[model samples]
Target: MTEMEWEGEFDPMSDPEEQRHLLSVLDSFRSYRRLAHFNGTHVRRQAFYSLPQEHWTLLSKPPFSVLDSFSKLDDLIDCNAELAEAIFKAGFRAFLAPTLDSDWVASVVPKKYADDDFRTYSIIMDNMKVQTSQNDMEKARSCINQFYREWSAEGAVERSKCFEPVLVALQHEFDMRKEADPGLDRSAVHVLAPGAGLGRLVFDICRAGFSVEGNEISYHELMASSLILNHTENVGQFKIAPFALSCSNHLSRTDQFQEFQIPDVHPSSELADAIGSKVPAHERMSMATGDFCVLYSQHEHKHEFDAVATVFFIDTAPNVIRYIETVRNCLKPDGIWINLGPLLWHHISRKEDDEREDKSRGRRDVVDAGISDPGSVELTNNEVIALVEHLGFVIITQKFNAFESGYMSNPRSMLQSSYRPAFWIARRKPSSS
Candidate 1:
């Protein structure tokens, strides 16, 4: 999925709503930027290195000129000059130290700005005064309110690393299948995507003219995805800036601020046209929320789907063998299974209490297989392939790809992740009976 290119310039003076939204965003960002400057100077001695690396690499190099976008604002104060003066006028004021106060703002800020010393006060005010296109200033203000948009459907980082590869693979498999079988019904081809985050893949598949469904387990995510896919209209271009690491040394909680957006997914012309031309997205694609393993066991779905695409799923279960079995049973004879993700085992343990809890929650199939442990069973790539073949699957294509992937990881930490995700397309072996 190609990101929507930045279109016409943002005219803040033209629209009052847009103007209000822009100022509000700028206000918040100024506070955040000031906080970063403070940490860069006092707290994090290596802030230049320790800060979150910019994901959206700008074309223009550093020493960026002031954006013409914000030049309209008449009252402006240079932050650099004020910051230098603050360094000179240092001992005059005490920074407002965070406290164990009840009024915690966003769980990151422990104290109110009202209690800060002169140094902290000056920095905040200076940030509010300075306006430039340097850093993420232009992109940030351009797409003001969209910072919290879902990454699966909108963010740049996820689109490049996750969605793009999956889309290409799906197209490759479809083309191959159609070539091998001239009678293949392209329009009627049905694919099931388990653990579809925000329905981006499913939506894109539908955009490519296929029948698709997405299955998710998290209620909150399911609802959110539904609202975004079905209710929202014509919002596409968004950005993701993971700059929350400056708030705290150790990331204690999920950083919601990191995923903020501009507007929201500005779908490519192809995607937009497909979505606009087809039956409403909500009607064209289906989203089911529940355990995917239990989905096939519901009696009527055996060997039902034409294809099963699992991206970043599979390892969610304690027994991935069960997932293989489920896929085998769910796919029609010679039906394909496309999987792409690391074997990052999610199940930590199968303690008696955990087993009881699983059963109570209707996960009766979670039985101990007498492996190394109940839940910590991890299989190598070769072992997984062997097990798939044993279950009567013929590997069509297989590949090992390493991609940078981090699920809202701390932007300040040197901790980067690379998932050596294995991609495989296997077909159910025809029954000999």
Candidate 2:
């Protein structure tokens, strides 16, 4: 069987649904200005307008006038608009660039070219359109905050707490393997990072001299990561006020308006520097965009990876057992599987139709097939380990409350939330003949 590279870019003609989804995501970015204007500006201003006339007089004069505050918000909204434009353009370029092929060109060519079997095409961004929804706008806003967690220097502390242990474990395993096999090549140490949202961990693994691939299923994540991983050229190249939209949990207005520079490290330059000439940085790291189970369970992928690293990912399954089975099937004999994150169980409350939508997006669940109901088998940490053993894995390392980390948290917000997640490393047992 031929190995499928799985670049994750869907062909527009063949996969119209995915194309529509991509366009909708792009439209969300494009609608940022309108949404921000209505939600941020208009709503807040209306509250101010409702105040008594005497109170208005007090807010109008003084060290900081109400108009002055509104001016600052307007400016912040403009900055967000600029960032949204960049995101939309980057996503457009990344997703559509691959479609400039002979077949695609022939479809849009002139009559003469069509008759002669010649091909010509021009990609017009204006011609492609999609309407944005309230849901899309909300996700777009969330995606902006994700940049803080994934790329900003201010988020390094949280990322270090969550990612450092996984990195150390992988490196230690690599060192032990090198000691056992003196001729082992770092390039041959293949690692797979499933549900690699925004790809910070994947970049770290590749920098540690291991060939890595990141897999993600969210269009929001995939589009944003494409811009950062592929198009970014410099450190701190973009600035964003991630907390600008939040109206609560602020000790000071300065905290609310705080701006952060994104991509603390330039992905391409840093990866190139670390990997050197042994393998091109691009070849050392890649991203596969699809469901983890479906993509990795294929014949060509069986026994294909030396290690699989999952961070804040596994709990997304409706049937976590299927996830365990897929991990076992994809790993070579005695291959390692490292996991970190709490048992949040994303699909616990999802309706049947929601489960079907997930399956359509490549996520498989027993609930959709009538084999189980939502949250039917939510397991405790020990039960999860027991299930891992039952599915042909031997626990190598396990820990509870491994680390405290925040996801997309605002440092200045008065309310702070965190997760004290479980961490483990398991080895797939050799198959019995």
Q: Clashes in model 2: which pairs?
A: none
Model 1 global lDDT (CA atoms, 0 to 1)? 0.51
Model 2 worst lDDT window (10 residues): 116-125
TM-scores vs. true structure, each candidate = 0.55, 0.86
Candidate that scores best on TM-score: 2
lDDT of 2 by residue, 212-290 (tens): 9989877777777877777776898888888888878888778889988988998877876884237666677878977
Q: Give the per-residue lDDT digits (tens) of candidate 1, residues 1-433.
A: 3321111222333454333333333333343345434433434333333544552123123332112212211111123222222322221111112222333322433356546544443444353353322322333222222223233234556445655666676677668887988765544567888887556677677777667778765322343344345434445322333433333453332331334432255333335467332343333466665567666644477877888888888877677777888788778887888888777776564345434433433423444321122444688878888988888899988878656665434444545555667888888987911
lDDT of 1 at 183: 65
Pick out the ten consecutive residues of candidate 1 with the lowest summed lDDT.
68-77
Q: What is the C-alpha lDDT of each candidate?
A: 0.51, 0.75
Residue 226 of model 1 has an lDDT of: 44
